[model samples]
Target: MNYLELDTPALLIDREIMEKNCKDMQDYADREDVALRPHTKTHKMSKLALFQENMGAKGITVAKVGEGEVMASKGLKDIFIANEIVGEIKLRRVRELAKDIDISFGLDSILQAKMVEVAFEGAEKKARVLIEIEVGEERSGVVTEERFTELLDFLKQCSNIELLGVFSHDGHSYGAKDQEECRIINLEAQRRTLQFAELARKKGFLISRISIGSTPSMIFNFPILKGITEIRPGTYIFMDASQANAYGNFTRNAATILSTVISIPTEQRVIIDVGAKGLTTQRRTKGFTATKGLGRIKDWSGVALENVFDEHGILNHQKFHDAVQVGDKIEIIPNHICPVVNLHETAYLISDGKVIEKIPVDCRGKLK
Candidate 1:
């Protein structure tokens, strides 16, 4: 069946475009001689993760242990949880997963390392972990050399932990004013990450992987610093409005929300079936990936979602309202595809306007 015939408020993935996106990123990684470990948090689909792996991705990257479990159940063996994992229960779950697969997670503090050591105590496999280096995203990870030294010194006493390597996320590159700024930020972040890896190696730890990524940085194809082993970009798999804006076009956008015109309340007002609940309320306010409104209409240039309620999207454009009539199906490219995908249960894979497959968001709400 045609995607247009599908129910309103549906998530649609252009199969051809998505496949191209996967190939493009993988090819870039191969050319750079770096491993591609695309983050699965963007699509949350095990099938897509497997597809990426089969297309030359060395491994898969996930944000949570639950997502790791879901992907492992679908046959992904090498998994890395890129976020810091604390708490006994969660660490125990990670421990259980490490037994069957090559599993690892992030660590930034000796306290979390203690939890990991205890959780994996007496287990056959030691807990493999990576240290997160803060590279100006300012969210997590060690920010200063002194604290990093402290954490490393403490890790020397841990008996059940194996230091995998160091990783960093140049997320702030999304807010870079231009390509030059993004390049600077990407290179600096990679340099800082590699510096930490060298520090760890100097301290007698075998830092095998020096991973770093952010979609904007990778999309710009900035020079990868030597010794950086892997790139873990998530949003490249399903380009959103923000990423499209960064690229100056929507041609690369593979995911869009398919909604139907529900009402034309006035000549200046048009309402669609999807709202914040379906399309999300995210907007990129700065940098190259910055978007103007909540979302962009696919075929309608200069028209955007003005406002959104729980179940309604308002378009305050006379031309758009006049062009589209009630019951007309429209596609919207969301500002941020990551959260928008988590709000959906399944996404329809479309090829040449035909619904080719239904991919489940298996890791949806796998926040634990």
Candidate 2:
């Protein structure tokens, strides 16, 4: 069936473009001699995760235990929960998963390490752990040398958990002023992660894997830094308007929100069917990216989504107001693909303007 025949406010994935994006990243990882463990949080589809695995990805990276469970249930054996898994409930869940699959999660505190140790007490397999280091992102992970050594001391005595390696994410690269700043941030992030790995080894922990990544940093600094074993980038799968703004264009954007121009409220504004509920309300600021508005209109470079309510998006620009009318359809590249994907239940796969298949977002709303 044709894509236009479908209802408005739909999520569409260009199959060709998405596959190309996957292959390109995988090839880059191969050339760099780093393991490609693409994060599944971007698509949240089991089949798409499998598609990445088939394209030479070492394993899959997920943010939550529920997402790891969802992927494991679909026969994904090697999984890494990049975010710190805290609390008894979540620790028990990860421990249970380790019984059948090769599983690992992030840790930054001695308390988390102790909890993991207690959770895996007397388990058949030891819990493989990665110590997360702070490399300018400042969101999570350990930054101070004292705190890292404290966590290392706690892990040294634990018999149930094995310190696998260290990992870091240069999330701040998204806020870089330009490509040069991105390069500096990526190198600094990698250097810090590698330095911490050496610190762990000096403290008697036999470190092996050293991972660090973010889409912007990965794109700008691949094969330049050494000693990093893996790269976990989620957004590269479905390039968004924000990524296009930082990188170049939407030619690599695989996903788009299909919406209709519902009303021409004024000569300067037009309303779209999708708003916060469908396309999300994430915006790009001065340092994040060069995106000028809420979202980018595909092919209509002169127009953009200036504002959005629960169910209505206000399209701005004179060309947009003049060219678009009520009932006209437009495809939008979202500012952030992650949250936009979470808002949809299913994504329609398209090729040559026709629907090829429909994939369910099986991991959607798996917050726990």
Candidate 3:
């Protein structure tokens, strides 16, 4: 079946592109001598996760507990809940998952360790917890070696939680001015992550993984230190507009929102079926190139998605609008693909306009 026959506002994945992106990123990680734990949150499709595993990813990473459960149910042996899984219900679920697979998660506070300890005290199995060190993301994790050491000490007391290792996300490395700056930030992030690992080792901890990297930091930038064992990059598999603008160039941007020109409301403007709900509202920040709104018209590369209503996207370029008409299908390259994918049920896997398979977003809204 031809994927183009599908209705508007449908999510589509170029299978060839997705496979290439997976292989390329895994190759990079292998060449750098680091374990590749591709984050599954980007696509939320277990099929894609398995593809990553098939392409040489050491393990897979999910952002939520539900996603972790879904992957584990599908026989994914090594899974990491990269976010803190707090609360009795979530911790118990993580512990349950650990019984079958190698389960691990991020830890930034003693409160989290205490929660995990209490959750699995009677179960005889303990979950490995990676103490996240803040390397500039400021989103989650311990900021100082003292805080991480204290967290490790607390974990030692808890018979139900094992100290996995140290991990950090150099998200700030995305803001680097050039490739040189990006590389500097990458090395520095590894440097900071290694420092925390050394402290843990000195404290008699069986520190295993010295993991660090975000797609923006890891793709173009290389780390100098061999102490870093694993590289965790999510966005490299599906480059978006913002990642493209930040990470040198977004050559592997496999994912895009395919929309249709529904109406020519005016002579200088045409409306598309994809709006904020379909394409998401993410945009790029400062860069040498320009990016705006939810998406850009693929036919007209220079034309940006000028205006977005609740269910309509308006492209207001005179040269671009003249060629478009009612009932015409057009491709829209989304600014960000993650959330854009989450809003859909099944993304059609396509190759040369042929529908290969309809992959379910199995982890959609699995927030619990």
Best by TM-score: 1
Q: Per-residue lDDT tens digits of candidate 2, residues 231-313? A: 99999999898888888767999999999988987778888899899987787786647677788899987467889999999
Q: Rate the local accuracy (lDDT) of all candidates.
A: 0.93, 0.89, 0.81
Q: TM-score for all predictions?
A: 0.99, 0.98, 0.95
For model 3, give the 10-residue run with minimal summed lDDT.
Answer: 284-293
**Tens-digit lDDT track of model 1 for 262-296:** 99987689999999899889999998888888999
lDDT string for model 3 (144-214, tens) is 77787788778778887788798888877656776677777777888888999999999899988888867
User: How many steric clashes does model 2 contain?
Assistant: 0
| Candidate 3 TM-score over all chains jointly | 0.95
| Cα RMSD, model 2 | 1.2
Which number leads on lDDT?
1
